[model samples]
Target: MTRPDRICVGAIAGSFGVQGEVRLKSFCADPEAIADYGPLWTEDGTRSFTVKLTRASVSGGVGARLSGVATKEQADALKGVQLFADRDRLPSLPDDEFYHADLIGLTAQDTGGVTLGTVRAVHNHGAGDMLEILGPGTKSALLVPFTLAVVPTVDLAARRIVVDMPEGLE
Candidate 1:
């Protein structure tokens, strides 16, 4: 099967009051900049949405109205829908920075050239991005910190990552 069509940029977290506005949880580094990407598509490519940021709240995320949504009920109905932008429209990263998508399939290896696994996913839990590596023939995935000490080299062109795993971490 073809790979999932979209990378999640945001999520609809229910409606924002009685208006058409919906609570948007953006996964972008700068949450408000999600609107700059223009129309976003669904995972299945069935629906497209244009986001208009209205306000931000303390507990909830930014308030936004989708293009075709007209009421709070409509907004509420779309809760949990993941939004995505075209990969090409995303801004280029600096030398030391890398987009999560670019690292997904790259091979993971130790500094000594021993194979570890392939990157199964990239996740950031408040502190920093962690590489979830799924080793060959192994069902369990290992979460490795994506810091300089652990991941010394990231050769995007070569599609490989040379890691100096933490002491006693195999």
Candidate 2:
């Protein structure tokens, strides 16, 4: 589907100020490139907006103006909205680098070939990336760092990942 070719480039945290600007949290490698990806689409692709970086917010995120958003209320309404860019417009990565979308749904296993679970999501809360694995018979998810020593092999062709979990981390 067309969705597969779109990558989540950033997200709207909420309105920036009394004006129509928005608080944007960019997930791009360059951060500023979020505004250069042309028109970004909402998760469902039902809505689209062109982004213009206004200024940097106090939280280290950038304030942006979205096309057609002309009031604080309009910007506030877009809180938590994910902004996606066309994959083709974005720069290609090196062999080792991967977009989060490509890693999602990949099967994860332990060093002893124990099935960990499927990768439900990849999160980066200012620290390094973490893989949220949803294992069988588990109400809660497991969080594993996405470091090379922990996750040794990532075979996208095989749709599988091999992780060397540390002690007490099953």
Candidate 3:
């Protein structure tokens, strides 16, 4: 389960160099801003680190130095570790925008008010974002494009979304 108080911002790709620098893959809209948020914490909230960006990494991520990580082995050991920041430290979105975490667990309904499923996850693969919905008896998940026309309503307060499922998607 994800913590409501924190939001994932980035992950450690691996060690960047022999000097203990790490390759950081940022999930933020403004990648460099990932380090602007105060101290970043591990998913479990056990480890915290202050980030100092060194340069753009060859792996398409940023080269950074994390607090307490001073050895190549130490940086390598943290590979794939997801980093999160306190939600309050992040900027608020516009009315039409949302954090991916906010969409998970929201009930999904059809345009006619029929219950479709629950949002299990949101994915973005170069093109755009897609919502993954899993219904009561479905083995395979329903993949719905998360465009303004398709996902017409996202009522966070009501914890639900209204979708206009495209033809043949049912």
Candidate 2, superposed: residue stretches over 4 Å from native: none
- Local accuracy by lDDT, each model: 0.85, 0.90, 0.93
User: Candidate 3: TM-score?
Assistant: 0.97
Scored against the true structure, residue 112 in model 3 reaches a CA lDDT of 91
Give the Å shift of residue 30 in candidate 1.
1.6
The weakest ten consecutive residues by lDDT in model 2 span: 54-63
What TM-score against the true fold does each predicted structure earn?
Answer: 0.90, 0.90, 0.97
Q: Write the per-residue lDDT of candidate 1 for residues 8-112, one digit (tens) a residue.
A: 788888888897888888888888888888688876778889888898652457888899999988998999888888877778778888877778899999989
Provide the lDDT at 119 for model 3: 99
Top candidate on TM-score is 3
Which portions of model 3 show Cα errors greater than 4 Å?
A: none
Using lDDT as the yardstick, the better of models 1 and 3 is 3
Error of 1 at 163 (Å): 1.4
For candidate 2, list the clashing residue pairs, or say none.
Answer: none
lDDT of 2 at 27: 88
Best by lDDT: 3
How accurate locally is residue 38 in candidate 2, as Cα lDDT from 0 to 100? 70
| Candidate 1 vs. true structure, TM-score | 0.90
